[model samples]
Target: MAGPALLLIALLLATLGQAPTARAEPNVHIYAAASLGDALDAAIARYEASHAVNIVPVYAASSTAARQIANGAPAELYFSANERWMTWLGEQGITLSERSDLLHNQLVLIAPRKDDASSVALDKPGELVARLGAGRRLAVGDPAHVPAGIYARQALQSLDEWQTLETRLARADNVRAALALVERGEAPLGIVYKTDARASNRVSELATFPAASHDPINYPLALVGTSPSDAASAFREWLAGEQALAIFQDFGFAAATSDAH
Candidate 1:
């Protein structure tokens, strides 16, 4: 699979109009993966209105976010699209206690609605690969570095379709980018998170990888070492509260933790 060209765009509101050397707000510094941009914004708004303080969120890939935190990026909270990165932080002793799996997502195939008559179908699992027998383009995140892509690749392997479709694959730097390719009709179909597929009307879901196809897709959230101990605990509690869980469900994510006492 060939990688897409770079097109860096700022998606975070707080990071906009601020240079790297500019003054930063004294609010909680949150380093989140890019995929969470939509969900985090909704969560932050409710949190600030109720809590009376700002929480700055910096969005990037989960791996990139982890690297920044490891290099002292001044992040008080770390929310990753996958748990592996958070597990890495735990290994480095940067995770505070009371870690929680915040959400669960599935990998799915999306295509332009106009292409609906084609071989892609949500109920049929290997149909896309069967249809793209030779060289139709298929977009996906770069499995080498991106967690979503990793899962996408793992799922394809489970279906025994990776090798057959390898030549026609167009790899993007992240899930959003891959979605962009399909939305633009650059590729007939793309592999992206189920939430992302639902987020856009330009594309329709073609198929979903079975939950048993790959490892569990767990999104874990934890307080980083830079946050105040008290505030960190408070934030974690609020995140799992009724308000936050509702927001998560609205954004098409399944709550990973049970509130049952």
Candidate 2:
């Protein structure tokens, strides 16, 4: 009996010594484009279910998000709607070497559901301003920086409508805010990403501008230098996986090809 008890005590001590250690929760901060809100939320939700890390995402225009990360915002990952902003951040020494193209978006014309006769052709430029009744509003993201806004301006300029509608333009800081302005009926029409229009029930897509109208929309995701936690890198890895690509496709964003810019 004494021998058995001693053996049991030794075994218990050995088991205690071999016990697994608890893992520390990881902390992650991500800066993302406003256009990615829905898709990114879904991707993050799926990642959090399996990982012990908690991710905090800040959504803004691609340019604005780039500025924040470059200006010392504590972000571990940056997802921009356009590669220009991503390159800008890289030039400023804010991005890592191993970055991947995340997704692609198409700029589209959207109008309030109540606006009946405003359907424009996909290939033709939107003449929303000319079609508007008195006091009608035309919404566009700030063309100076917002990628969607820049595309919208290019389309308008190509169609020779830029000068005619210039006075009625209501500029929003980002595409989402411009979408909101149109959804609320404050603006009769807005230009935003196709994904954003799908996410909103209040607005309806009038048309999609031709791909030739402006530069391609590519969203490239990269790890910023200040990634305080490895979880950020893990999340970036998962974003390039099939699961995240499927989620992005479901949200109306195209899966970025390897050759995607």
Candidate 3:
């Protein structure tokens, strides 16, 4: 899909002035990709403690979140795990010129922590399917809409494993759901973000997908439409500030996007 021609505004809170205080504290509603939950939640807590506003976060597959925003959801900002959905929002004219790529993540293969299976190096062409045996399954997000699933599919195809594993997949709505499938042993293995795997004690990393296998994982945040809320705008800037950057590292995300700073 093509994006609308619009100014990509840069939000600098110090120069922008404080948001007008509402009758009651206004909740800053954010629609985001599910994979952002841990880091974003920590940052929200800190922001709420120092500021009088509360952040309301709705996390789902990036594709799902983008569609929800386009359907008139009351989200003030959108955080997507991949640029495709954010660009989709741009096409809908729902995202303002003020946007920043907030963070980065890596695709990984994980399995139940207690499993006896040896780590399968993804560089080998047929290692993945051979480990699954005749009927065992691998779990992943629904590739039709989930960013993690799309990356997983790309990695598998690059390794020449997709033809063997595609039909055998146990697909889930989002990456975390796919992780749960592996955690519960419903599927012997699963594909998820490196951050997701780190957040879970129930799973262990088996392999990391080479960067060549898929597009870079980027988390982009943008003000939805012409957001007038000072609170929403302030919070958006805070996410890229030092405090949030520390929190992002704690939760397994890389440094903030270079371009946004």
Candidate 4:
């Protein structure tokens, strides 16, 4: 009985001597536009497989993400769908590091996969309205703030269809939401990035908007704060590298050319 009691005491002492395991904190936090969701996820997974660092990403409209960063969100890096929001961050004195356009996308009109319309002539006035039929609305990101919505507005305006379609829009929080509306058949049609349309099998693209109709759809990436973590900087650099660009291209995004706006 004395030997058994001594053995139990020794086990208890050994347990107390062992330290508790510490939880690993994320080394980098990325705030990216909603449209980059799938591609960015793939890129992160591939990068993490080779590198020893923890990365966490937040996806939202560029406008919403920029506001969050401006309001003290813990974003080590920002990837915007357009230059406007990134410029806004700069105006706020956010101090972006290594800023450059990383990718380019195209605006396209899409509809539910069940819709038989293969292509629509966007240059013709009243054609979109005819396709919308009666009482149904066209889905689009909220033109008030979303970059995709803004581009959609520009394209419509350029095509001389804005007045007719402005009141017929089913506004959404972001481009992905607009795409979801078309995919779910909540709206008969939607305007979204080509990449967004490609991501969903439920939606079929109707037409690609002319590049001259709107501002170039550029995705700019930057280190958010003045002193970004070394891991964050490395990740930013890798994103512009060939490996990451290939992943983005596979997802239907084009590498941003120097001349791209």
Best by TM-score: 4
Per-residue alpha-carbon lDDT of model 1 for 1-261, expressed as tens digits?
Answer: 123322233334445766477553347777887778898889989888877457789988788888888887888888888788888877776755566787888889888766444435534556767655456788988887788888988888888788867677888877888999989988888999999898888998877888988788878777877435565567777987888989978989887864221
The regions of model 4 sitting more than 4 angstroms off are 1-26, 258-261
RMSDs, each prediction?
Answer: 15.2, 3.6, 13.7, 3.7
How many clashes does the backbone of model 4 have? 0
Best by lDDT: 4
Clashing pairs in 2: none
> In model 4, which residue pairs have backbone atoms overlapping below 3 Å?
none
User: Candidate 1, clashing residue pairs?
Assistant: none
lDDT of 4 by residue, 1-261 (tens): 999999999999899889587666447999999999999999999999998888899999999999999999999999999899999998998988788898999999999996456788887778888888899999999999999999999999999989989999999999999998998999999999999999999988999999999999999999988788888999999998999999999999998973322
The parts of candidate 3 lying over 4 Å away from their true place are 1-23, 115-117
Q: Please give the RMSD of candidate 2 to the true structure.
A: 3.6
| Candidate 2 lDDT | 0.83
- Residue pairs with backbone overlap in model 3: 8-97, 9-97, 9-98, 19-230
Worst 10 residues of 2 by lDDT: 122-131
Identify the runs in model 2 with alpha carbons over 4 angstroms from their true place.
1-21, 115-118, 122-126, 226-229, 259-261
Worst 10 residues of 3 by lDDT: 1-10
True-vs-predicted CA distance for residue 8, candidate 1, Å: 61
Residue-wise lDDT of candidate 2 within 1-261, one digit each (tens)? 999999999999999999999987877888999999998999889989998988888999998998888798998888889888889888987646457676888988888876464577644444455556577768888988987888888878877788877787888999999999988888878889999999998998988887887888888888778433567778888888888899999999997764433
lDDT by residue (1-261, candidate 3, tens digit) is 123323223334533556665578888899999998988999999889999998999999999999998999999999899888888887886756578787999999888997574688787767787766688889999988899999999988888888888999999999989999999988888999999999999998988999889988989888887744999989988887888999999999997555541
lDDT of 2 at 18: 98
Candidate 4 — what's its lDDT?
0.92
